[model samples]
Structures are given as structure tokens and as C-alpha cells.
Target: MDTQIVRCRECPLQGCDTFRPLSEDKLEYLESFKQGEAVFRKGEMIMSQGGKAPHLHTVLSGMLIRYRSLDDGRRQIVNFMFPGDLLGLQGAFDDDLSHSVEALIDARLCVFPRNDFHRLMGAHPRLGYDLVWLAAKEETALEGHLVSVGQRTARERVTYLAVWLLDRALATGVADDSNRLELPITQAQIADMLGLSLVHTNRTLKSLREEGLVDWAPGNLSVPDMDKACKFAQYTQIDSKRPFI
Candidate 1:
């Protein structure tokens, strides 16, 4: 744990643009309630499935993958969590983690003990509303993922995932101005997320590359035109104002 005080108002990653700004009093209260910071190396588990969820984590930097494994050890990635995302809220309500969260890159997080967070929310209705708003956004994303896996073709699935990820990266300032986003997950992991075989996922990616829709090399992915990309994926943009927490 890093003990250096991290003031909420001074946080760079979860900016006011990405999340609703807290009032000065609310900020001070959160700063005091925050336990500290914790760092996770790439591939390290931040929260394990079925484990006690004692805290909620605010991503200060880097990326994380949320996944669940079956009885036979097959894993499906539920979502990619970026900077400004909140983690462990489900656990805060349920007492146990339903999925595991692992660092996709070297990451830092602000840790808030769940009990204190609950108390703060109880006292601050406005803050509590923000939390619900965050949960609803997460639910919308998950619903989209469910639709992708259940009805889309392999090529469309791949394209949809790519475009979706790029949009998030851009919104969160993870991507450079050139529209290039870092994708550190392996093809095998992607296959799991898309519900396809490894070979099928590779072929789909190759087709996407040949069509000039996307470029993937090493650890980076670039989308040349988001409009075209979304068209190929049959993506319909959801219109809603997102609240930042």
C-alpha cells in the first residue's frame, strides 16, 4: 500500500470531465475515508472471484480485465475496465465478488474500505445517486456484451469489440490523439470474450486488417475511421449522458 495522501480533487485520471465533480466538503470527506493507494503489476489479481470484497477501488491509472471462470477452468472476460472506472461495487452490495479483476497493465488504485464508503453514501444522497448512475452504465455495457456474444457473427463480434474498446479508450484519454489504443490482452483471451475458437478469432482479425478497418500490431490497435468501424460492426450508439463517479 502506498501511504502518500492522494487528494480526490487533485486526481488526474478521473477528471471532472469523466466523472461528476465532488463538492469541496464531499471531496474532503472522501479523502479522509480513503485508506490509501495500492499498485498491481500486470496479470496480478485485484479481486478474485468468490473472495470477500472488502473495498471499492477507483482506477487511478492503467487497465484491468473483469472475468469469470467456469467449473472446467474456461474463462470469459466480462469487460475491460479503464482509468476512471470503479471496481468492487457489486461486492459492496453482495459481500462477495462474482468475477475476478486482474490488472491488464501496471496499475494504481485508490482504495476505499467498503464500510466507510457505505456510510458516506448513506450520509450523502447526491453521492449515492452518482454511485447508482455508475452501476447503471456498467449494466448497459454488460448488456451490450451479452448481445454481441449471443447474436453477432464472428467478424461482427470482433469489429464490435474493437470499436467499443477504442471508444472507451478515447473517452478516457487512454488513446493517443492518433486513435491508437494499447491492447495488452492475448488473442486467446479475445477468443474467450468473443466466444470463438482461437483460429476463428485470428482469421476474423486478419480479415479486419485486410479490409483496412483496423490495424493491430504487437500491443497496439488503431481504428482508421470510427464511423466505418461501427458500420461494419452494426453498432448502434446508445444515447445517454454518463455520470462520472
Candidate 2:
């Protein structure tokens, strides 16, 4: 694998308005601090739970899934990663990872050494704030997911998930103008994320599809009227720029 470093100024993530703009010197420091880019193919594990892959990453392209598994092989998906989302944050200084991150498609990441995190923070305080902001945002997203699983009906839960993923993909520039995306996640994975049985998940998705609310094929997900679907799911469609790393 090539270890050639990607210049921060040339980063695709840097070009996205969703991310906060970096100062020239801070960008320079970032360009210097990064070791390189890492590529992980579809279904490839970037880091496993309990393994020490001591690095932080910013998604440059593609998507990833973070999950935790039990001894009996039951899995619970924690979150999905899109462009500009930071990875390996929760366990920055810990020896073992608390969860595993796997690529849902061919994904690229801007890699930085874990040991230099504090040095980078001490030198640039705002960057440290951005990191904390990212972590807090992730926590809030998880809270939303918990509410979905605990309170929502199966149809409501699945509808909200599709609309939410579509919104995120659109914000990150991964979705096409027609609101179609190569989502690449399986219904089984969705079941894991939503705490549903595979049969129930399939039925809910089929119902949604029949109503023109969603079309969730194996590697694709789309809605005929994205705006209407968002309204149905009660997802606030943001036209404003959002903050990111």
C-alpha cells in the first residue's frame, strides 16, 4: 500500500462547505502532521474491537460502519461514517478500540498519528474544539438512534433511517442530484442498527417501497420525492451549511 501523504489543501474533505474552514497555518500544520491516506475496500475491516490501531482518521470519500459484537456473534451497529466524519476518536489514548470500523464501499481516509493528537491540539486550540464538537455531535446522533429503536414503530423507524441516511449523504456530496445513493448497506445491517428482526425489517421496507416512500435495494436506496419523504419521516431538511471537521 502506498503511504504517500495527501496535502491538506488538496483534500476533498477540505473542499466541502459542510466542514469548517481551516486557517492557512493550521492547514499547513495538518498537512505536516498527517502521515498519509489509507484505503479500505468494501467489507474490509479498518480496525477491530480490542485491537490497537492507534490513529485518527477523517473520511475523504466513501462510507463506513462502526459496530460492536458479542461473544455469541450478535452484532450491534453503532453508527455510519460519511465524508468528513472523524473516526477513532472515542478511544484516542486507549490501548484497545471500543468498536470496529469497516468500509461499506471503497473508502479513503486521511490518517494522523495518535501520539501527536495532543501536540496538534496544544498548538492549535480551535482544532481541539472542532474535535470535541465532532465527538459531541456523534453522541447526539447515537441518542437519536436509541430513541428510534426504543420508541418508534417499525415503519417509522425504517422511514426515519432512510431519510436520515439520505440527508447525510446529500450533505456530504455523495448523493446525486436526483437524491439517489449507492447506500451499500444490507437490510440485515439495518436490522442490527434498529434492533429489528430480519423478517420485520424486510416487511417494513417492502411496505415503504410499495408506498413510494423508499426503494432499498441491496446496494442502493432512493425516494421518488426526497422532500416529501423527509416530511413523512419528520426529518428537518437543512438547506444551511452544517459544521464538520
lDDT (CA) for every model shown? Answer: 0.82, 0.83
Model 1: lowest-lDDT 10 consecutive positions: 236-245
Candidate 2 stretches greater than 4 Å from native = 238-245
TM per candidate comes to 0.93, 0.94
Taking all chains together, the TM-score of candidate 2 against the true structure is 0.94
lDDT of 1 at 206: 92
Candidate 1 local lDDT, 90-173, one digit each (tens): 888767787999999998998988867668787777877887887788888888889899999988888898888888877777
lDDT of 2 by residue, 36-95 (tens): 889989999998998886789888889999999998999999889898889887557776
Q: Provide the lowest-lDDT 10-residue window in model 2.
A: 236-245
TM-score of 1: 0.93
Q: Local error of candidate 2 at 111, Å?
A: 0.8
The candidate that wins on TM-score is 2
The local distance difference test score of model 2 is 0.83
